[model samples]
Target: MSIRAAYIEKMKLQLDELNTTMDELQSKAGTTKIELQEKYLKEMASLREQSQGALDRLDELKTSGEDSWKSMVMETEKVRDAFVKSFHYFKSQL
Candidate 1:
């Protein structure tokens, strides 16, 4: 596969993983106390927003030309990393 193709595939996998994590978190939140559940839901909403940002970056990367692909990749990676960090921190709180 071309570099761009491989990068896109990798991002798709990351998104799939994020979805799974979100689902698991949602399931846990359903069983928590109402007060904590409220917090969890709010954080989940933020996570979803971050996830959407990553998806948007991926879409942008898809249309970027070879000359600009590397920089786009870097930007997308930053989004992915931030999302991953937030996910881990949220998980730790549970």
Candidate 2:
């Protein structure tokens, strides 16, 4: 695959990992007992850290290229904006 394709694939993998971490944190928030809540809180914090690390890696990859990386950055920005719009729309409905 081309360098741009490789970068995009890697980014998708990182985003998937971050999504999993978010799911875990959301699941933990639904628990009722105090002990379970604490457990979830700890797990959520750990997952949050992991997700942040993945995001940092993504940023590093995104900026590391000289030519094709520009396209990747532009496309990624467009997708990010779409995601934000979708999120905002959903939030408004809630």
Deviation (Å) of 9 in candidate 2: 4.6
lDDT tens per residue, model 1, 20-86: 9898879888798899999999999999999899899989999999999998999999999999899
Model 1 bad stretches (over 4 Å) = none
Candidate 1, residue 18: CA error in Å? Answer: 1.3
lDDT of 2 by residue, 1-94 (tens): 9866686686777567556646754674666578766765675565556455556555755566676667657656555444445434433432
Give Cα-based local distance difference scores for all models.
0.90, 0.58
The most accurate candidate by lDDT is: 1
Minimal lDDT window, size 10, model 1: 21-30
TM-score of decoy 1: 0.94
